[model samples]
Structure formats: C-alpha cells, structure tokens
Target: MERFIEEELAIAKSVDLCAVAEYLGYTIRRVGKYYTIKEMDSIRIYSRSHWFRWSRQYEKGENGGSQIDFMRVFAGMEVKEAVFWLLDFAGYRRIEEPENRIVLKNQVVDKQEEKKTFILPVAAGSNTYLISYLNQERAISKVIIDYFIKKELIYEARGYHNIVFKGNDKAGITRFASMRGVFDKEGRAFKCDVAGNDKRYGFNDVNENSDVLVVFESAIDLMSYMDICADYESNKLALGMLSDAPLETFLTEHPQIVTLRFCLDNDEPGRKAAVELMEKYYQNGYEVEDCPPPVGYKDYNEWLKATKLLQRVPEEKAVMKSAHGMAK
Candidate 1:
C-alpha cells in the first residue's frame, strides 16, 4: 500500500493535465494560453505554462487549484483516489499534435506564463456620482436608487466615477463587482465585470416580509423594475446578477422565496438563461416564471425609457451638464 501510494503520488506530480481531461471525456471548447475544459464550465487551466496552476473562469469564486485539485473537483473523487487515478493518465498526451486536438480554433500556440488578478478600483467620496448618473441620466427612480445606495449595494469609484455594483457573500463581503463607467471609460463599451467576484454572492435586495423574488441580468434593469413597479410590491426581493452566472446561487440562497420571477433581458441569451433558470427552479418544487423585457425593448432599462412615465434618461448631452455626466 505504501509503495503504491508513493508511486501514485510521483505520477500525479508530473501528469499531463490536458491529456487526462481529454481522455476522461473533457473536450477542449476554448484553447489558448488558458484552456477551458468542458467538465468545468467556468474554470480555465493554464496549460503549457505553469506546472499545475489553474485559475477559476469566474472572477469572484475560488474555483481553482493545482492539477490534483482539478481531478478532485471535476471527477468528484477523494485526494488519494484522484492521485491514484491520475497516475494512470500521467503520460496520456503531449503539447504537440495540435493538428489533431484543441479543436474549435486553429490559433497557433507560443507557450508562455500568464496570470489573472482582480483589483477593485477605489471608491469615490460618496454615492453622489452614481446617484446622479442613474437618476438624472438613466431615468431610474430616485427613491429606488436611494434605497439601494442606503443599503450599500452600489457606489461610485474614485478615479473613474464609475458605477460599482457589488455581489456580496453571506458575511456581507463584496465577492463580485460589476462596474460601468459613468464617465472617462476605456473599453468594453463602458462596462466591465471585475475579476475575483463570486457569483454565489450575486447582488441581492432581500425583504424578509416578501416571498416574491424578481431576478434581472443587470443592475440598471433591476432598478428599472423597481421603478416601474414602485406603485406596489415594494417589499418584493430583487436580485441583480450582473450576469446569468449568479442565478443559481441567488435562488439557492433564498429557498424561502415562493415565487421566482426571471426578469431577464429580451434578447436570445437573456431568454435562454431565463428559460433554463425557470426550469431548474420549477423542478425544485418552486413556482418559477420567466418574464423577459417587454416586446420591442432589449432590456428593462430600455423599456423604462420608452414608457416616459418614470424619471427618463435625458435624450441629449444637455443633461450631462452635471459633474456626474451621461453615457451618450
């Protein structure tokens, strides 16, 4: 037993991670300096670079570790069991033979080390910048915006004056953050999902008195829903996932929620996610429904704009006439 364990340990220490994954039915969906394995949806393995350092495809969650950890996580096996199993596939494949492998793309490879890290920008003096942008420019209701700000869910970054929407854990620590530039934006269409955010801690506004939970794809949409429905149902809980990644986590965290309303975007991806999440929760014995953004509108924010009943986004830069400024 001791000799077997020692041998397995030695083999696991120098196993070919990519080959093992391929042999075990994990197809490489996206390959590059980082390889995205099918088995782990949001986990990227840094192949041909570091010894066994992999990073979570997710920015907020800690879903990363060494090759051994990869086996344990994806295979659902114990440490010793993984070590033993990996030994058999240690010499499974090699870095060459790209012609026959790493499908879906024909990009050439020059093996080099790369690392990803998440560092949240500094917060500005107060929520003044964000409040002005969302209320005056975006047309989101002041009452709804003020409510979230008071709850500490949204803020403004110091240098950029961007809007920072937080995904917080049970302990109230900011695990994930979604940032959109209110001014002085650089790239990605004025939006960025900062790394190191745990989707499990997706943005939530819970009202213990209410059993209905409405979910949205972005923070602006969430606030828009609240704005439109401000006449009633103020107690309904709202969750802004920043993306669909946190839908499961948010649902899981709120089992007491009897009604799950997916108020996602109206586009293909949004409808797809809403359908999936609705089915998943409905199967779990909860009442689930997907109410996508109204027809002729791409998102709730847009829908809100067309209504003109609520505080509407300014049609011109005449509104950016404030220190907070406007998107257009």
Candidate 2:
C-alpha cells in the first residue's frame, strides 16, 4: 500500500468536489446556488468543495465532507484509493523510493524484485456465458460479437468466465487485455485490466482504408456504437480508460486518419474529456467532432439498451409514451 504525507493529503483534499464527482462520471446540474447530481439528486454540492447528501443526512446526521469523503461515500473507494484517485485526477503521480533501496529509521535496506510477464487468462471451452451476457444482458448484436470473437479479439476466460477484450499492436501481438465479469456484483459489473497490460494499445477495430476514427470509453460502448451504426464505415478504438494514450498511439500508427469522432459517455467526465480532447486534437491538425450519446443517456450502451427497449414496444404505445413524456 502507498502512504501519503500530510501535505499530499491536503493537496488531494483541495481538489474541487464537483469536479471530482464529474471525474467519477456523475452528471451535476446547478440548482440555484447549489448543484445536484442528476443520477443521485439526493446529494447536493455547495461552497465549491463541500457536499452534503441530504437523503443520508436524516439518518446519518449530515453525511458529507471534503472530496475525500465524497469518494468514500459515493464512489465507494477506500481512503487510500480515494486519495490516490483524487491525486491522479489532479494530474499528480506519487514518486516512491527507489525499488532497490529503502530507508527505515535512518537505516538503508536493499531488495531485489523479479519482473512480471504479461499473459492472457486461459480460455474457456465454450463462450456460452460470454455470448449470453453480451447479447441478452448488454443487447449487443450477435453479429457484432461474433465478428470480434472470430478476430480473436474477444473470448471467454476460464476459471472466472470473464469476457476478455484483447488489444493488439501493429505487428498483431497482443499487448493489452481488459476483463469484464459476466455477473453483476452489487449492481456493478466487475472490471479490471490484465496484469502488465499496456495502455498504449487499447481494444480497437481499425480500418486501414478509412480516414475517420470513432473513439469510445470502453469496448462495450464501441460495440454499442457499431450495432447502432451498422452501415457506417470507419476505424474504431476503445480508450479502455479516459486518457488519450491509446488514441495517440493509434493516430501515430494510422496517419491516414484525419477525422475523429469522440463517442464518450454523456456524463460529466466523458463530456469534459471529449471537449478537452477535441480542442487538443483539433489544434494538432485533425478534424474533431464531439459525438456524445443523446441527452438523458449516460453512454452508448445505455442508449442502445433504451433504443432496443423502445423498438420492442408497440408502435401506438411508443407514440403514446412519447406524448406522455412530452406532456410531463
């Protein structure tokens, strides 16, 4: 575990709570002098860096504090993880002591460590769980799933039955892999990167002949976009994370690409990232377009699910539903 000094903790706490909420993918709306999260309206943000969960206040007696507390309560991160996340969000990376040297009580100590190798998890005998999770639960089309499976970019891992999304370099060597559990735990699906996975090569479907690139926040979002826009032809890349390392690598590999479409989530973090990236890339001589999901939808996957749900409803019922929503 990493330890932080008092100054480090203070710096982390100094980060804006509203911005931290946005970084965690929550949408905030201004209500008079205070701000409330759209997804969880019970929480109110005020005084710049302070917040209060009014719903919890009745029971917990005013449950709120600095950004660290917000992370602990809302983001469900431990104190250390919350602090580390906040520091990272503020563009701070902690520099630890040299790997070979350690000082304890003014005494010098030395240690040796072995480097770890990158390896994909063992494959499962069948993709029954993977297929069902993607098609039935996620609403991703069978054709799109099959296309990626055929390319060996996706597979069901053994032991845990996780859906592993692999990333390959220009030479077709697997360099990165992110795993997603088929089952939901406490309403959240398990997700993590494989050990030693490289962020420079994110899961992607690059079309050498296309000059346009569509970027998404995750593999699921990328597939959702593909399912929605079946006829469109363009290169697609999943950033895996919000940073642009993968995008930069892809651009370096595919200089023919001139246009970029950022299809990140419509939430605060996604929107802010899209705007920042658009400006950065636009200044770098690339035509950039902000292609966020429609209003009220969080991400492409959610939008796809809503679209599928609407399609299943009877035509008259759909019209009536739209009319009712409009009336509200």
Q: Using Cα atoms with residue i matched to residue i, what is each candidate's TM-score against the true structure? A: 0.54, 0.63
Candidate 2 segments whose C-alpha is farther than 4 A from its true place: 1-114, 315-328
Candidate 1 lDDT over 63-85, as tens digits, reads 66655676776678877777666
Query: How many clashing residue pairs, candidate 1?
Result: 6
lDDT accuracy of residue 205 in candidate 2 = 88
Each prediction's RMSD over C-alphas, in Å, is 19.8, 12.5
Worst 10 residues of 2 by lDDT: 182-191
- Per-residue C-alpha lDDT of model 2 across residues 134-203, encoded as one tens digit per residue: 9988999999999999989999987557799999887788999998876441123456788778889899
Q: What is the lDDT of residue 283 in candidate 1?
A: 89
lDDT of 2 at 313: 82
Off by over 4 Å in 1: 1-119, 184-188, 231-245, 309-328
